[model samples]
Target: MLARASAATTALTDPGDRLAELCARIAGRIVFTTSFGIEDQAISHFIMSRDLGIEIVTLDTGRLFPSTYTVWDETEQKYGRRIRAATPEAAALSALVADIGINGFYHSKDARLACCHVRKVEPLARALGGAAAWITGLRADQSGERAAVALESWDEERALIKFAPLFDWTRAEVAAFCAAEGVPVNSLHAEGFLSIGCQPCTRAVAPGEPERAGRWWWEDQGSAECGLHVGPDGRLVRDQPE
Candidate 1:
C-alpha cells in the first residue's frame, strides 16, 4: 500500500499525517471545493474540527438543487467558514447558448459536453488559477477509474497540488463520519442519489445501479460528464471539478 501510494502521488508518505498534516501545511493558500454532499461534508467537518486555515469555496452553477444551496449557507454559518462562490462567466454562457441553441445540451452528446465546458470547467479554472492546492471530496469507491488515485496528486493541467482527504474511505465510512459528527449534508442522498450533479443532470439511482447513474443518465456508453472536472485542455483530472 505504501509503495502504491508513493507511485500514485508526489505528496508526503507519512500515513499518520496524510490528511491533517497536508491540510495544515497547505490550507493557508489552499481551498476546498464542496457540493454539500456527504463526502464533502466529512472533509469540511475535519477542517472545522481541527480549526484548519483554508478557504472553502463552491461553484454556484445557478442551477443547483435548493437543498444544495441551503446546506452551503447553513454549513458556513454552522462551521463559521466563509463559503465563497464562483459564478458562471456570462459572456461565455451567452455564446454557448447562441451556438448550441437554448437547452441544446439535452439534445445530443456534443451539446451536453459543450454546455458543461462553458458553465463548469472554465469557471473552475479561473477560480483555481491563483491557489496553490485544491481540495476535493473524492472516494475510490466512486469509480473504477478512480480506484488507483492517491490521497494527494500532482494536478498537471491546473499545475497545483490536489488533495483528496477522504480518498481512502468507503462510502459507508464517509456517511458514518458525517453522522457521527452531525455534519450538514444534502438531503437528496437518502433517496438513492449515489452521485449528484446539477438538478437537470441528476436523478435518483435504483437498486443495483452504478453509483454514478444519477449523473448524465441519458447518454449511452462513453458519454458521461458535466465538464467541471475536465481541464480546459480537455484532460480529465482525478476528481469532479466543482
Candidate 2:
C-alpha cells in the first residue's frame, strides 16, 4: 500500500502538486504536522489553498517562542480555519516536570529526551492516531542524520506511512515559495534561525553550521534531533526522492 502511494507521486516535480496528489490518494486519513517554521508554513499554504482535505495538526510544546504563536495566529486568520492542536496529557507532563524540574532538560540528554517524549512525541502519537499517513516539513539538508530523508517511507514507530514532501527541497526553494505565496512564517527566521523549535532548546545557527544546528545546540553536534521522525534503529528510512 505504501509503495503504491510512493510510486504514484514519484514523477511529480512541484511540491504543491505532489502534496495535493498525495492527499487525494490518501484522502481523509492524512495528517500534516506543522511547527509554523518556513517549511511548515509553505506546506500549510499548499494544503489550505488547495483545500486538500488533509488535516493540519500542530504539537504545541508549550515552550515555543512568542513569534511562533504569532505566525500560528496569523495563519489561522489567513486560512480562515483552525489548525488542530495536540498537547501532552496533563498528569503525565506534570509527573515528568516534577521528577526533573521544568528546566532539567538542560542537565542531561536523557532528561531532554524525556521532556520531548512528554511535550512533543506523546502528543504527536495522539494526534496521529488512526491516520493512514503523516506528513512533515523535514528536509535532507537540515542535518547529517537526516541527509538521506525519503519523500515516502513506512514509519515503524507510528505504524503508518510517513511522507516528507519537502525532503528534496532546498532552503532557498522554501524561502522563495514562502515569500512568493505570502505564507505566514515565524519572524525569527529573519534572525538566522533556519530551524525553529522550543525557545529554550533552540538558538540561531552559526554561518557554517547545519540548519538543525540551532536545535539542541548545547548538546553534542550530531545529537540534535528530538526523535519524532527517527526510526527505532536511530536512522531515517531512505527511499528514492520524488
Candidate 3:
C-alpha cells in the first residue's frame, strides 16, 4: 500500500520524464531549506539533479552542530551553487545572553522558545521574505503531527506554496536515496543523532524514541515546534506577539 502510494506521488517514478516536468514547473520561484538531515539531502539531490533554477537556502541558527556546517560546505562544493545563509534577528544572541545568560532557555519553555524565535524563526522569516514557494524535507515518520502531510500543498501558514517532496518517505527510503545519490549527509546521523538541533538543546536519540525527541528535550515534546510554522492568521509568522 505504501509502495503504491509512494509510486503514485513520486514525480520521478519514470525517472526520465516526469521528474524534469515537475522541476520545470516549480523551478526558479521554488526555494528549498536544508537542515542536513537524510531526507533533506535526498530532496537536495533530486532538485540539483534536475538542475532546477530554484534557489537553495538554510537557516544557520548560529548554534548548529559542527557536523551540519560540514554538510553545508560539502553540499555547496558538490552542487557548485551558493546556498544563501539566513542569520538570526539583530543582536538576538547578544540580547538574549545579556538578559539571561547563554543557558537561560533551560529554565523554562517560554524562555527556550524565545531563543528559537530570535535565533531561527526571525532569520528564517527574513530569508524567505519574498519566496513564492518553499520546499522542505519533512517526512511523516519524523513526528506525529506530520503524519497527514502531503507531497505538495499551499501552506496557508507560510503564505507560500509549500512542498514536502518527501513527506511520505520513511527512514529506510531516505537512507537508500542518499546511498544511491551519494549526497552529502550529516555525520551526526551515524552516531544515533536521529534528529539534531543546537548542541545545547539536542542529544542523541535513544532506542526507539521519536527522531525529533532530541530537540528541546527538556520541554514538552509538543512544544518543540519552532516559530516559523504558523500563526493565528495562518501566514508564516516569525515573531510571537509581544
The sequence of per-residue lDDT tens digits that candidate 2 reaches over residues 1-242 is: 44346555878878788888887676448999999999999889988998887899999989999999999999999999999899889999999999999899999999999999999989999999999888899898888888888778777666677888898999999999989988888889999998999999999988997898898888887757897977677666654322
Q: Specify the poorest-scoring 10-residue window by lDDT in model 1.
A: 1-10
At residue 149, what lDDT does model 1 achieve? 58
Q: Give the lowest summed-lDDT range of ten residues in model 2.
A: 233-242
Separate clash counts for every candidate = 1, 0, 2
Pairs clashing in candidate 3?
A: 157-235, 157-236
Please give the CA lDDT of all the candidate structures.
Answer: 0.72, 0.86, 0.71
**lDDT for model 2, on a 0 to 1 scale?**
0.86
> What TM-score would you give candidate 2 relative to the actual structure?
0.95
Tell me model 1's lDDT, rounded to 2 decimals.
Answer: 0.72
Which candidate wins on lDDT? 2
Arrange candidates by lDDT, descending: 2, 1, 3
Clashes of 2: 0
Question: Could you arrange the candidates by TM-score from highest to lowest?
Answer: 2, 1, 3
Tell me the tens digit of each residue's lDDT in model 1 across 1-242.
10122332335443225555665455336778887888888778877767776677777777788988888887888987777888788998889889988778789888888787777777787778788787788776776546665576667677677777777778888887688878988889998887877888899989987777677888873435465544555544664222
